[model samples]
Target: MSTSEPVPDPSAVAAHSAPDAPRAHAGSAATPALRVRTLRLEDEIDLPAHLPRDLTAAWLRHGQGMVGIGTAWTCTTSGPDRFEDASARFRELAAAARIDDEVGTRGSGLIAFGSFSYSASSPRPSTLLVPRAILGVLDNDPFLTLVDVLDEQEDAPDAAGAAPTDWRDLFPSTPRAERTRVQIDPDHTPDEYQELVRRALGMIEEGRAQKIVLSESSTVHLEQAQPVATLLSRLAESYPTTWVYHLSDVIGATPEMLADTEHGRLFSRVLAGSRPVAEGSELAEQDRRAFRSDAKELAEHAFAIDSVTSRLADLTTEITASAEPFVLRLPGLEHLASDVAGELREGVTSLDVAGRLHPSAAVSGTPREAADAAIAELEVRDRGGYASPVGWMDAEGDGQWAIALRMAHLETPTRVRVQSGGGLVAGSDPVLEHAEALAKSRPVLRAIGRPED
Candidate 1:
């Protein structure tokens, strides 16, 4: 890695340029008001298994989290102003929305699930979606919340028509039996991916950037349209440690938490170096020890650590980071991981923290702009939502946001793109880096039933 000067703190930098005023979306002025009602359920329910095929949004880990059904309101924005524009509009709506809570829990009241693109220039619009109904299990308490958008006269519908009285009515009666076979094909030749890695190494050699992350995608061709809920249930069951997420067509289990704000506290988990673990190897300690001592991996990890702490220091108080990184073992891979936390400064929303900490050295390279420029030039593909912040935030400005990793995007009924990438330093081997990307992709591949890679 280059011994170049460290990148400036992201908080010190100007926020992404946004319109002077928030632009309206479907849930904005179009609907005069939104009425939200939360009710506790008598029986506990499995969160992912109940996710419906259409208009579903979820963020779950260890079988506990929120699942949103049907869109009550949604906002889409693009360009540099995407985050700011969406955040402003959400704050406005949440502040105005009405709520009647019979079950007071973390995810109750008005909540919006969101996914942002990795780059401002991406053609895909970043989105924030408020579900018409929410099925959630936090701290083992099963509950449901319904949101009803009021018409122009600002009058809510009749009580019977406004919200479902029984939580059982909200869940699907039976699992869909429909299934489809999937074929995983490389979107780009291995040689092409290696060339991109070589170019990134050249940039590092020339001191253009310290470390750059390069990613590639694979096309998962399905024989026919498959139910997303089934695929998500598989992922949740297989990778209980990861946050299995679904926002629109985007679905995956991410191991990295970009930012999680709750009850006046902020927390984050950063992951960088990675190595594949044999599926059922009993002696994985050897690989774990080797990964820990590797100088290149340590260097890559340090950059990610500094990037997070610096940005967090600006938005939080009493900030502290993990003393040493620990190996986080997953289904087919393990990563060097560290946790950072602090007490939130007043009025600093989770989205605000995400904006400052995003493009962290783990995803983008050190000296953020240079690495971003390198990614744009070398990859030559719009990273629609890969490596971006994908999670949900509540009306209270407290929410969990995870880096969109180990994910696949369903482009259409028959086409899905599974993507993965790794960090590259001065001595990064193109061949090895390419292999690492494939290793990182194992989780999603295994989830979709193609474990033999």
Candidate 2:
């Protein structure tokens, strides 16, 4: 349970870095690489199957891996132009390099990992990072990229000589997974969050808003800092059905697919209107019927669907959405989830799609401007990276972005903050909404080593 490894000094690693032979690379942010070489291999290896689950600036969803352990280059930025700004930086790096890929897949080349704030105005950090090295498994082909940075070497070397022989050589054999547990402490008690929920409902009654997403955050104090790989492994095991992610300091397993684009095909998953699933409870017949027939749940889900399709209307074609939502069950909760997919019209990028669809009614609320106003007035602390778009982007502008839900921020060496929220519509009950927030939060608590009912 102890996170006591003596991490190597980064400067020592960078001193030996260089690009491969026959390639020269120069980026404004990174020292010029004499050459960049990538060792790649192909197999039928299931995406994440049997891979050493190490802590990297990475993500694993639906079996694909996006690893960012040793980054040679990184971009940390803020403001409304954050996404485009990061993309521009990647462009600068790409313009000056030659990449050697033994096997070419979507994730075979230049890679970046991102974690953005819920709002542009949020004071929290927003980042886009690129590893100096990558151990990626895309479509079952594994690759390791190494950059050799030589200030002044009389002899340039072959890519193979400059890089580790095996990807396994990149990371040390780590400790087996842990059983670290934490003491749970919340920013607001259940009753206090319920009061905030009631206040939001009152704002709706006053005709100030149609819906509000009220959330609660908890700071968990561990006996020691939880090991990153151990925590990530537990999350992946606990929520295999979701996208388990860790980028910089933000981490979680989120079920909501904000946007995904591949070869001009796009898909987004909308989740709203939730119900808790106890650890070992098979719903009786009546409980299932009410979830399907409840007017409040139905309305909340409808708003989510409409929010997605409407924003995507002008950007896509052959659009299709599920006529009705199906129940999506996770470890401790269930939600009304709908899938919306379409083909990109012509020049639409995944980032554009994510930007437009972000703060969807599912997370922010209806009539976004008003809902944001309510949250700004009600939420006492910044949301950091929770409930925002978090994922990766490639040189081709094709990628996957998911709503950063069920997330926690590793605040410091000994502290982490888990966050969760609920959508409130007319006829909403504060007590019920508070319970929903707790259910949303429980996943992170459990993942961080709290094994409890």
Candidate 3:
């Protein structure tokens, strides 16, 4: 997407409005470029705290990542080819860009923060957005990058000359959230969801699929609209280790990485199998041990790992995976977790790898095609953006994308939909699966300031 209109002055950090249209192509100008200028900052930034209240986009994890305001351009598409469409559009923008990067790091120039829906059939279009101004921190160093699209008539500005001495002054004011209460309503009743899991197990037994992931959502109705920044800040504070993201209407703190590609390296974290970790340390450790040894959980986790590696094998070299999954502890549960790494092929972008890795046995089921069919037949409610990829990719096609887990969709000012699910195998227990889904929902629920029921 490109625009011929003159971009706002780089010195102005105030929020600006983006076009409402889906695609903004560079008009048939003789020359058009996506111009990016990076200015390294002198001080360290305290994330979530330093994040502005009205952030348009963000991808933060472990106190690093970027927060952006306003939209410079957008590449939005729907249906099965969404990933390809967005990737091609971004590649064009990046290929023709003019960049001055003093920082010259992974995320230093021309970044598009993206969030894709879980299903291609979803009416909600997946988005790749380029924010007008960005403040980011990577490798413990902070920097500011001003992004714009320039037509043949405009001249690219100098980075150092336009940068402010005090980068802090660029930020807008943040306001506190009003204490709010929410009305929660599950999409499927406990019994209904249990029946769904039972049906999935039946399908597995009948040889339709080896495993199927079933999810449930609860609509959170607020008395009044709550600021998304407040919820983002709360999630970041509580789950600092998870990727805290807010792109358009989707917001979450996800622990599972769908893909993280930098230079030629590809890294992914696959999570499956779960045990709710309540209060007692001894009990939690016991649960962790039992979880590690449980045949059902181990089998479920194995399916997830294989799903990732098999796909990586096609796009990467020297692929490596953990021999055994480690216990990944979170606020309310522990997951069987494994890390997979590889070197990407010459032309594979992060999105390409993500499209292939998504709906892995971790999220879908083994025998992907069969599992997805079962999900369509059995699942009454749509998954929306849950279990999908959400993150940013720089102009270099190097970026991070995480499964949109532990997340909620702000459907409106007052209504947020929170979702969670678990993998189901032939011997899975419906009641236990329902409990596990609830356990997975805790982080977002707690972040919303509500105790889990």
Candidate 4:
């Protein structure tokens, strides 16, 4: 990893003509850059769900260095129906903001989307922003620098040095539900579900792929409408340790990982939900102990650890993984957890690890390929961004990326697509699997102003 500090004021960097801007070098010295754009629903006339995916994939295939992208939209109710029409409006906003010119640009940047349900009591209009820059000192350290940028932008004078909105305000707080009621649809059945698990287990047994991560999604019809923000707040508060993240139109809440690229580090707290990482927290020791020892849960966690370690061993010179798995608890569920570390080999990059370890066993199954194929066949809808990797990376081969969960895709208030899935194993039950999918989606469902039935 590059040993450099982020520019205190990224905006202060001397601007060069668009054509003359210094290009980012993959492994060379160059300071990463940050730029933000403001977007509104009116800007997006009509957009497609695959636009963002296409843009991101194209960048990964052709662009160098780091990248970050974000989009936000507002849900609006039209007539008695026509929710899908509204969703299209939001998607258009996202497509309009794509960074097409950055394909040949040097360095790295990120693109993302954000939005809120139209019914949100605190209706803060949504905005989608994308930043691009050549990787340099800033590339080495992202989250801190990015967080700083967010802070700066949030604090920047808005015609008057008024606060745009703190992170807290962007995501509102709500009461926690002691027992989250979830509903699953038994009608939608995909035959590939069972085959995927079998294929994954077969691969592990065959040694073709030591470990594979597989994921599956199930659509849910809530009992009642619940506010998306309230749901997210409850999940975040319930599982404070998890790296809770929300995307405009994806599914599920993810709170287990954070990336610190500058130090050549990828910090993952591979436990699920709300389990304790320390001793003196809200959860009792006995509860934590029970969570830690559950065989089924531990098996789920061990797959993640082994997969991560195997990938790191191939990319780094040295590695250290926690010997024992622990418990991770969230508002609605709990999971086993562990941590893994390694020093990136001189020329190796996190992207390499990301490519190798993505779809970790936590998301997929024991063997990767079979599980992925199974998911593709079994799932009722194209996941688009739901389970795919989402995060930022820079030119220095530094940036953080995490599984895009607890997310939704907003076409409009009336027309939105929400997705959720679970890791299935031999012993996995359809009923339980369906329930788990619902539990995972709680975060995004709540964010979009949907009431939990």
Ten-residue region with minimum lDDT total, candidate 3: 5-14
lDDT of 2: 0.71
Stretches > 4 Å off in candidate 3: 1-32, 154-166, 279-283, 451-453
lDDT of 2 at 49: 36
> Model 4 segments beyond 4 Å from truth?
1-129, 132-240, 244-252, 272-288, 450-453
TM-score of 4: 0.52
Candidate 3 per-residue lDDT, tens place, 1-453, comes to 222222211211112333222123443343236677888888768756776655678788887888876666666667888888788877877888888899987788888888888888887778887776788888888889876556435454322122333556655444457646777889888899998888889889999999999888898877656666677777887888999998877888999998999889999999999887673332346666787999999999999999999877879877999989998877777788999999999988899989888878899998999999998898777787889999999887888999999998877766788998999987789999999899788888766655333
Candidate 2 per-residue lDDT, tens place, 1-453, comes to: 001110211221011222222223333334333345567664443434333333346678666675555444555656777666666665655555466666667776666677778887877656665555666776666777665433435445434333555655554343354555677888888778888888899999999878788778888877655666556666777787898887766888999999889889998999998888786564566887789788999998988898899999898987889988888878778788899989998867777788788789998888888998999899988887989989887656688899999988877756788899999999998888888888888777776775333
Candidate 2, superposed: residue stretches over 4 Å from native:
1-38, 42-54, 147-162, 172-174, 451-453
Those runs of model 1 whose alpha carbons end farther than 4 Å from true positions after fitting are 1-31, 158-162, 173-179, 449-453
Model 2 TM:
0.86
Which 10 consecutive positions of candidate 4 have the poorest summed lDDT? 7-16
Cα lDDT tens digits, model 1, 254-293, are 9999999998898899998988667754226776788888
Candidate 3 vs candidate 4: which has greater TM-score? 3
Query: TM-scores, in order shown?
Result: 0.90, 0.86, 0.90, 0.52
Worst 10 residues of 1 by lDDT: 1-10
* Whole-structure CA lDDT of model 1: 0.78
